[model samples]
Target: MVAMVASSLFASLDKDGDGKVSASELRGCMAAALGEDMSEEEAAAILAAADADGDGLLDRDEFLSLAREAECAADEGGRYECLREAFGMYANAADGEEQCITPASLKEMLSRLLGTSQHLGMEECRAMICRFDLNGDGVLSFDEFRVMMHDGLM
Candidate 1:
């Protein structure tokens, strides 16, 4: 099922009729359907993680690799795992650390996940942190992230 969905998704993402998916193509597709405006940095990071041949593009296998990780979103326990992966992807990209996600990092993640043309502002990101930051440290710890996901705050 994931295979078929990933294939179909890949086709939609490959708007240029090319066999592989480029960062721009991926962003354009996300921006269109999900209405999210993925920044070049975010798109590049995704492609970087998925691109197998280091060609800066996503082939079938590459896209499937990402799809498999995301497939976890379907299950309750795995949903947290999926969100953890997303958090790691953006958090690690920002500072090469996994401690916590700052407002800037959250902004980057929201830009890709929201599927909205109007990307979230820093104030919004800060507010999100404020809403979820249990320790009141102005950043989202993994524990806080779990709470946000559990609350379906996305």
Candidate 2:
């Protein structure tokens, strides 16, 4: 069951049906799977996180590693719970704007989404900010946020 689930997850991430996952492909997969838009920078960060070998791409093995982590975390309760938490954080950050997620807001949002008070220290958030801050203004516009989140899916 685990292998099947892992395989499915990997296959999904391997967009374009290619045997290998390039940096761009992985970014697309993350956005699709996470249901968020992604900016070019955000796409890069997601790719970097999944590309364990640092080969600028994600292989099946690397994807499985990430899937396993997500699976384990989800098993604690449910994947939807985690996703819901993330959505709530993002929604709050939106603050009535069409595009609510900014780099600073994403930091706070991810911290809550990942359920970490401080130990993890918002590594994911920082990574996202680093990747998506297009104007070098240290923030992401709604469109940028959407792109980063929804790269491959849409």
Taking every candidate in turn, the Cα RMSD to the unseen true structure, in Å, is 9.8, 15.3
For candidate 2, report its TM-score. 0.43
Q: How well is each residue in 64-150 modelled by candidate 1, as lDDT tens digits?
A: 888887665478766767778756755633456557888897787656644455488999888878988899988887888887766
Output the number of the TM-score-best candidate: 1
TM-score of each: 0.48, 0.43
Candidate 2, residues 2-84, lDDT tens digits: the string is 55656765665565667666767655544543567567786677768888778777777777787777667665357546545
TM-score of 1: 0.48
- The C-alpha stretches of model 2 lying farther than 4 A from their native spots are 27-36, 74-80, 83-154
- Cα deviation of 147 in candidate 2 (Å)? 33
- lDDT, candidate 2, equals 0.58
Window of ten residues with lowest summed lDDT in model 2: 111-120
Give lDDT for model 1.
0.75
In candidate 1, the residue pairs with backbone N, CA or C atoms under 3 Å apart (3 or more residues apart, or in different chains) clash, namely 34-115, 35-115, 35-116, 36-115, 36-116
